[model samples]
Target: MAVIDNIHERILATGIAEAGALLDRLGAPGDPLWPSPTWIPMRFDRPLAVGADGGHGPVRYHVTAYEPGRRVEFTFHPRIGLTGTHTAEILPHGPGSCVLRHRLVATSTGKMRLLWPALVRVCHDTVVEHLLDNAEHAVTGTVARPVRYPWRARLAVATESVRLRAVPVPENARLLKAALPHPDLADAYAVRVPPGTSLDPQTWADAIFRNPPPAVTALLRLRNALVAPFGIDRGDASAFDTVARTDRELLLGTDAGHLDFRASILVEPDDDGTTITLSTHATARNRSGRGYLAVVGLFHPPIVRAMARRAARAAVAPRPQASRKVSATR
Candidate 1:
């Protein structure tokens, strides 16, 4: 068994009552304390209270104790091989100030002992620091020095992104389904859209169209040049026409002499975060179209996956804060 104890704390200029109130709002919509959309959100089966069962991401835990406006404790689920408790508490500091602290105490057995130090610890440290930064930002409207992820943490996050799986085209993507009723080929990939980001499918589609992956752009140029001699129309972003749309889904397609294709962008809410699914459907118009489809299909999945990942990153990226202009006063 490997014993583990971790603690993260931030001194807030706000009073104990104010800091405690932040704790009370944990797992609530628009949660002001736990960093989200960028990180897995803290959630429970029901409203936060003693016995509330939920944990962010793969970790499982249940609330064991709760003191309104003061502290809360959670014990890790035994099945996860983490036997211990984690607590969030607000402690009074000096006048008009308090400390928001999160501490975790657990023992790891078997493979967890190896996984904990190698992978879990790095992610845990980064997450806890981000949580503290969120607490500070909530209390003071800004963090004095926000936590930045190191290279290792970035690598970990990238690894997770690469593991995203292909999912069936969402049933709610009615527009895309309607456009290609019997497509010869159909594929879909899904990625989680971080919380606190826009859920608008149009916004995501625009992001992808405006800024495609560099490799895909290069490949498209080469494809256009090669097919030019055959009098084939260039396959480019500009050629796509919007077929149908709603708040949750956007369908875009293009018709060519060889093949007709449609692409769907769908946004659906999930317990952990919002899911964005990108689906493709295509129909070959002739034998030549079948040949074209086979060639294009080889490259389609990766290119679509890359574009989807890029769009997700662009959506979550922090926009530059508008500069404030100060006027001179007499």
Candidate 2:
């Protein structure tokens, strides 16, 4: 297919092996850079290889080709007018250096002409830069340059609260309905993880939201501390309160005097890893509550996404320890 729009970026990295490893890691469910707060979360149904089926959000695709530690490409199944391939590749420079690149080439045949540029392209460009930023950090332990949104992108973000709209819950959310009888508003986010993770749904929920990792805890504390000067109150170590719990799902709640929030994490096991979805709903009972809701909407998407990403990361792997021991080799 002829290429309609494509983005190519190359960044120097410390080691070929490391860069290649990072390329593979980028496809994992827990990748920190992916599923950006403002972008769709991505995953593969099975191990990275040809024929694996998966894609981000509503966009679905099948892996067309794969080369371990070197590259992977996908051919979309036609969503709207989006067709063609998106590939992530690693080009080694020498034993000690390499270049990491991501290229998306596709043609929009229908409504995509309107959707692709206005929506996908804008977000894709920013997301690629972010991926590179993450790659540099993973390969060299330092970012050559920090990722920054252009002024237009920044404006889009500031107004995203207006553009953001909730999509219907997936079939797996049947459990959530039993808990949230009448949700004023509902939204959900999900990602695929490695199969057979020992952590159960409830256990993972507790660790991710109820008890955050040490690093996240410290960061939250620092944020709260900074807000203290402005006389703003902060939640305790347990950022949320559990309203209800069952074997496969846990409902968490938060009360903001005027506004009330309820969210849950439902774990659905599959042949591949578990698919974890963070679903949430908010209610406003009074005029003051309605006012609060209006303000909260502006930042709700990113906030919920950040929480989901943190939980997804924890669900797939154990949290890293703060201290590490270095052994002396004889």
Candidate 3:
């Protein structure tokens, strides 16, 4: 009920507008989670707390700050009435960067002494910094995948009418992998999706190689497609830019300037098939050069996930084998 307002940093960035749009996804309305689409929802990452009390503890949070492209704040509302406030802010500056700040304020009522390190950090500057760098990537007409949410935060994956995951994968490892050597096409992200719901290996390969779905195009927007939100919605400088390099990495630049993201694809074989990991990273040199800018990663784990499920769906679905023909080669 009381008022608490503060500004964390200055503003600049030629790509501020695009950065704001990305943040808008987090607070967009009518999505099952967040009360509003433009704010942090309560159920965002509650499951990560399971290991704390043998999987039986009160976990609740309320949004105290919800502003598009600026700040997001939340308060802890424990069923047992524990006291504390969690505050978070995303301050965007210049044309291609933003600063992220997170603070926790907790007061004990009676004898609640400190236990853990007051607060712990799973993600912060590293994640948001990646977002800002990708904004520049967006501007240069390149696609850079943001680190996936660790398995713990991932929570669940929904496909039509099914959810999978017997046991949870760790939070830190789930979303963040070491910088992969190359961009991940279909074969690279198999591990990131559900085990085996509906996506087929063959179909998956064709999808990325022949016609990739959302995440593929989202990651490879440099190729140019109307379906890409960041690529198509961006300015002509980024949209029309040609891929200067196509091996080891993809280099993108615009007549206005150079875009700040690059990614490559790496492949490795497994006992059954393969495990592809796509890791995308970004950079911000000077914030003041481009006008104020904000950053957001258009994240859709389940959506990126469905592509995998679709492969499983295709694999198990009825298929005609009579049409199969063999070449004359013995």
Candidate 4:
């Protein structure tokens, strides 16, 4: 096996102990100073120490050595054809500064040599730049530039069309209309409930006003986990406000940073029941804004479905007796 080595270093204007501690915690889930979104958020199954086993996604590694407030190294087991050890260390550069260095030494014999240059190098360089930026920010309370996703890294996001079917609850339409301005529905997981089912309006109101269904909560978590790695900012649920509402339609708006977006839930009453349609509208300010919107567009469909389904189910499902009293006043 032939060997390939890469070394990257940065000088942080901080004490050795501080820099070392930060270096030690890199690649863990809760390290505030690590450049998490640069590549992907890395998570360890255990605490940072020798013998800990963890990595992000399919790239697995084991901690090989550790020196408190100084250095830590990992021997990686790549998903494909690479064997290596990567180390991060802090060395005193002066009275109150230190050099943080990362060294990657590996043997790549087969397809890994070709793959490394094509895929891994871009990711590696970005991660290193982020680490340095984060270190500098910790030492001095300023980040030189806000991190943006590289064009290459943007491949992590895929454009997907969203399709959702809204279930109607005609009996509870009146109840739902009364419960307007309830923003939590925007994040719920949807299930298509058929119309004409004997569902109590009060019960459905209680479910919506008081608490979300467990299935909806699970769906929200799944969605968050799916998109978090891509560095997508899912604006806070509380930020979703009722911008417009009427007897037949409701509009919820949220500040998505790059764009002003709204989710519209249109309800049409028919002889059989009501047909609900969940859709999204946005106005991007510029090209960057449009790009941001496009990235977020990948998630908009399923999320809208979740919101509509949750609202539909909550507006039709029977509320528990214990929560009925609480639902009546709200």
Candidate with the greatest lDDT versus the true structure: 1
What order do candidates take by lDDT, descending? 1, 2, 4, 3
Write model 4 residue lDDT over 59-148, tens digit each, in one string. Answer: 678899989889889898766566888888887899889888888888875777886778665556555655666676777666544334
lDDT of 2 by residue, 183-232 (tens): 66677766555543543666656656765556655666775676455433
C-alpha TM-score for every candidate: 0.87, 0.50, 0.29, 0.50
lDDT of each: 0.78, 0.62, 0.33, 0.55
Off by over 4 Å in 3: 1-12, 27-60, 79-330
The ten-residue window of minimal lDDT in model 1 covers 321-330
Compared to the true structure, candidate 3 yields what TM-score? 0.29
Write one digit per residue (lDDT tens) for candidate 3, span 241-293: 33432222222323222234332222233222233333233333244212211
lDDT, candidate 4, equals 0.55
Model 1 has an lDDT value of: 0.78
Give the distance in Å from residue 48's predicted Cα in candidate 4 to where it truly belongs.
0.6
Model 4 lDDT, residue 71, Cα: 89
Give the RMSD in angstroms, all C-alphas superposed, for model 2.
11.2
